[model samples]
Target: MQGTLNEIDIRSILQLIELGQRTGELFVEAHSGLTNTALAESNRSLLSSGGFGYPSPAPQPDERFWLVFAIDGRIVYAADRSNNNLLRLRDYLRFYQVESALDSTQVPLPSANPLEYACLWGLMENRILTPARARNIIKNTIEETLFDLFNLPQGTFNFEMGPALAPHLTSLEISPLTAKIVKQVQQWKQFYPLIQSPNQCPVVTDRDRLQQILPETTLANLESWADGKTSLRQFSRYFNRELLAVSGAIYPYIQQGWIQMSDGCDGMPTAASEADPFGIAPLLVPSEQEPHQRAPQVVCLDDDTTIGKTVEYMLVPKGYRASALCDPIEALSQLFREPPDLILCDLAMPNLDGYEICAMLRNSKTFRGTPIIILTGKEGFIDRVRARQVGATDYLTKPFGEEELLMLVEKYIGLPEIAPPPVLPSE
Candidate 1:
């Protein structure tokens, strides 16, 4: 069992494929006790927290999404994107048929930003269907496929994304040397805070990977990337020479695992010198785990410190949506337009205090008693009492822990709970 993770092979990869019924490729390499795996769009490493730079645009997938494993710095065995996409589509189809019975046929096929509705289709229209490829597409099934896909978690017998009953792992032996290396990863617990930062991106090196992830593209042009030779950043960008590409364009690619930033390769010097390849990171692959099941949305109303880092970190892992509004005025304006699930307000403001805003929301028929939480540097019972009188649902002092804030949200908003998976034994 110990040796199974040490240096994985294609057999394990194939099992993941067959079980997940995913498509695409899986890559892994091991020397000594270190192991690494790479998940292609088809691979199931989507489960890993910070595994790849890209996720298949197709929403359907093979594994549980969490519990993805890694060998060293690479993916070894993982789910396939194609199969995952197919499963997602199947779910959508089942849902659409169950509720609507094909009567409301708007033709809800998988759609990518640039690819055709039939891009996945292989035939002359009759039976030719392109399989699922990206994670987003599978998730955003024309609003019609949700009937079947959303009901799968019920009735038990859930499918998992690990080994196929450990088919002769060759040697179950684990060495002390390997365990030592695996233990090194434990020190990174501090980085746990960064895991939920959705904006954090991996490096993108492939153009096709970018093309697959982006909203729209004209693949009809750009020849260098056509051969799969150019880096994803190069191929994916349209006149990508713009400076904003890194922040705007490429960042999303990194988020999706189509590419990855250079992580320290094994044995590479951590201390930088003028000689290294400005990057020494591992190639991004699938995350090797499942995505969070549910996340609550958060509306942060603050102007000066408007950045919602805490909210972003708390909700991103669970795939929650968060919106930031620096001005309480703006937050108030947005509520009538579109109400967020939860609201976080500040006690004092330049023009209006958090209490005043809460009162205004309470007056509204739609927002009355909305889960409003207050954050203030000042700590006093009178202030707390005032906030509660104005309809604040929860309150906290400044400088809060992520868990504390998240708990408040879970209690008030009823967003889904998603527990992260346990870290696997390393090395």
Candidate 2:
């Protein structure tokens, strides 16, 4: 129940836990400063138990991530020390378009157990997010976290056996969740050539061109949702479906060039549509006198000068103050001095890549709640899972368009509203 990742593979460890029907938490920590080769060597020890392939060019150390399992050894929840909110639950509710039932300002007290406890409590107390919906959220969250852990390459782990975790919303069998995630990860890899990343926003280039092939219902859904705005990832949330399903639905349109992926904010108000299906003027828009304010600091870390500059360019026009750093080493010091509202980091660098930087920040109390997004050319399955493991809030693929970058930033920290352009009457 206690050993370094070098000693036993995650799959084997999970099997043993399940076999023993263990209940409690498994704590994993990777020592910092281990080179890629050192990491691979350590992981080789893990695979020795059974010959499962380990991640090549292994992850760096400075570890901490946990999996809380039930007596049946089903993973009930997962998190790190820095996680201090029910934001994921909030996000799940919002994604399902049920956030309106709850108030954001009031959050329940912290719990030693899963925040799902607090989340389900709030939803039931207010009679809002719903028990069924809450159960789905918990199940999905735990499965997602387990999927990340299953792909983890190296770390020292300690298992603490104790009574089963309390206030369960739903229980998932480990075997099925594991099997499903494995299949999903493999399937995700297949879509890489056509869909580089889930963050790619699908926009209609020519409606007439698309209308020829797409069904009437499909075309309507595309027009209302695409708008050169929503990312494949966002679409997954809107439909309460998986990322692959959303991407698959639009794949054919992409090939025809009728729909192209663009970088842009979801300018059309989604909240209004979800809230007022009747289509009245937004119930939430501010009056003209309350001029949109500008100013949320954003920090970008990338070795490529162009990428850094491009991020700054995209954010500046949208009323944000952005700073870019090509050196990941220096970026840490800068963040320590002036914490930004959001951070965009690249995965590859000469020293201290995005993963390292993200983990360092996540461990710090100062940056716990701040959003850290990974910007990278690599869209591999393991890469995305690892990004989440280190506390990245989102992942944006390289060569991102202007709107794509802006929309992602807005998703985390909203932008100030600009005045509507003057309407010029036809002469």
Candidate 3:
């Protein structure tokens, strides 16, 4: 029955509700329109069709769904499932029917919502977005919200939400946050399958165009890529295949400079050279060799500590510069006043713990651009999570291997460079 319902019935029901003026409230059907009251009255038939409740009407995949919102007999807004707002309303409707039972004047949107909408608000507060951004952010937030709420299969989730939003979709996007009486109706209309396939997600490509270039493959990676890591191998381990298969699948991308294989890489699985996948760096592989360099600078915040000497001993000739400081507070101050390319600090310090220092540095206008590492005895997934939360670029547990530490450092500071190409390359 859910699959059978179409646009005409949805509009017809909205007309009926306005005509009747009966206002207990209605919630997100999840996927239903109010079946006739007779359908509700009949217990056996409804039960067999999967419920007394409404069906979750997923749109025909990666397409816009229109939700018309009217108040006091006039259309006020619209939202759609593409933005995942339909799913959001589905979650909220599980407790309170947005359609059948809303008391618009009395209720307030949660001050702290457990949905993507809340994070969207946060994104706005940070000035990370602009006026031209509302439509896309709302769509992305809704998609994000729906993905979480329904545990919706990832393929149907998309981030290719473009610059313009239809009026109906925009209405649903903002409905739950407003104080107006919302008389809305939803319609599943097909788009030309916008950025992804009819049932696919976008690949976070530097350009939205690539999703069009490789729809099926993009759909395959949505959930696995959501953690937003740079490594493609990490995304495909879920497929239970050898690394080469995944690499071969995306090899065209590498040739096009979409990813890169790392040095010491034996043609093993590597990202496209351009790394357009990560949306960082272009599709180009640097020379696969260690670079000529002065030394990697490693500054330890705890003065009179053995860390500096140990690092220095491990330093390959022309590979590292190790220095120590007794006072973390002073070191932090000095770091900004006269900075190096990288900083490593102990988490447990006398004047300020690693977290506090990191916050200060991150908040400081001068050090805002610098990357800081934390050396902590506390190390676990949770600890690493917290380290990232506090803005540490990377976390190193106590008793770490020398190689582990350097690799972590290298990943950020980047390899050393040769001198600039002699201006204009004298012929």
Candidate 4:
């Protein structure tokens, strides 16, 4: 089943699938052109009032945004390639003041479907986020995903019927959930004049000006929230309020020149260098991982002996202890014997393919959250999705350069802080 979002609204699409009790996946990819124009048309005034106005004619979107629905016709799981869901999940966790829990918890690598794994680690596995809390988080996440999808002015969707996602800890009924979300989306549009994009981060303009006219309580809220680090999307999640509602509440301040919107979290700047070719930012933060004296371990697994050898060659000189295995069967045992901080496995291999190896490793408690990057010749969307399904954390296409490999490795395990081998002694 397939059609443009214009031909079939998301609500109708939901009802149609629900009525048929279809079991499969729904994929939505929205191109930038018309979608951006529609969004800008609705909220261009807000943009003009802020730090950066929307381009007169918004530039063409370089890359398409995507959303995936994992359903047994009941909507068991939903994910997006835009990082919107992931950001929402993070803000939702932080909204409940559970940021510290995630700080210590290690998330699996291929977070192409982060909402599912976050629930596993935060809700069921660690109990950091209780089942009940997890449910609310899931609800908010799904709501946000749907809200974004519904608003897309133009997009193509494809549904492939197959076996449904399994072991779902929770499921959302389509009928009522759709109704509630539809209402929320309507209300969200009402705030368009004030909030241009949820991605915009809010920053306080002047404390003195804010204090002069605003009540103490309201002023405090602005101070705590408008510290230039929280995006409007995050602000909404933090309060469990609709995006529009939160924007409306702060609209007065914005108009009074007491606050302004900027890009990134709480007005933090985003670096283009931080984003990968696919636009997915590495979930691992370098500062989050403490520096250590010993080099981090990295293991490369590929049936092609040269590929493994090349990985070792590239990593060894960079202060890493690297090893390579041509046999996937032996790779598992070797991984268990000395668990490397990161593993790179070839996707297509003889005697237990990379997917099987990844699935096997993920089954183990120790490696469940380990970084398992797939080295593949294929870069198609389906192949990447399959890699995620089998628990591969990330993928690098075959014939990748040394810099690509190093960047990925650094993203996961981080680069060692070597002190130049005490150069003073040689001098």
Model 2 pairs whose backbones collide = 263-403, 263-404, 264-403, 264-404
Residue 369 C-alpha lDDT in model 4: 51
The digit string of per-residue lDDT tens for model 2 on 331-398 reads 79989999998999899988698899999998986786688999989879999999999999899998
- Runs off by more than 4 Å, candidate 4: 32-64, 68-72, 84-86, 103-123, 206-209, 217-221, 263-427
TM-score of 3: 0.30
Residue-by-residue lDDT tens digits, candidate 3, 268-371: 22223212232222121122232213334567675546775555554433245556677876787678666766778777787688888888887865565456
Evaluated at residue 198, the lDDT of candidate 3 is 15
Q: Assess every candidate by TM-score.
A: 0.30, 0.48, 0.30, 0.51
**Number of clashes in every candidate structure?**
77, 4, 41, 7
lDDT by residue (tens digit), candidate 4, 1-427 = 7667778877888888887878766656575334433433423332223212223333344534443455545776565543323444556675556755665676554332334444444454675764445645656667777877877777766666665554454566687788887787777677555566777777787889978876776666566666666677766665555666667667777877778876656333222121111112222122213232345788999989888878877777776777888888877888899998899989899979888999999898678557899999986999899999988889999999999999998776656544222211110
Q: Which stretches of candidate 3 lie over 4 Å from their true place?
A: 1-296, 316-318, 380-382, 418-427
lDDT of candidate 1 over 1-427, digit per residue (tens): 2223224332343344444444232322111222222223223434332222233333333332212122222222222222222232332233122212223223323332112122223221232221211222232331111111221231111123343311111111112213332342233233333221112333335667656634333322222222233232221121212112223333444465554544322211122122211112212111223232234467888664534655665666654566667777666778779877688887878788898988988888577536789988788899999888888877988878878877887666544433432332121
Between candidates 3 and 4, the lDDT winner? 4
Ranking by TM-score: 4, 2, 1, 3
lDDT of each: 0.40, 0.64, 0.40, 0.65
Which prediction has the highest lDDT against the true structure?
4
Better candidate by lDDT, 2 or 4: 4
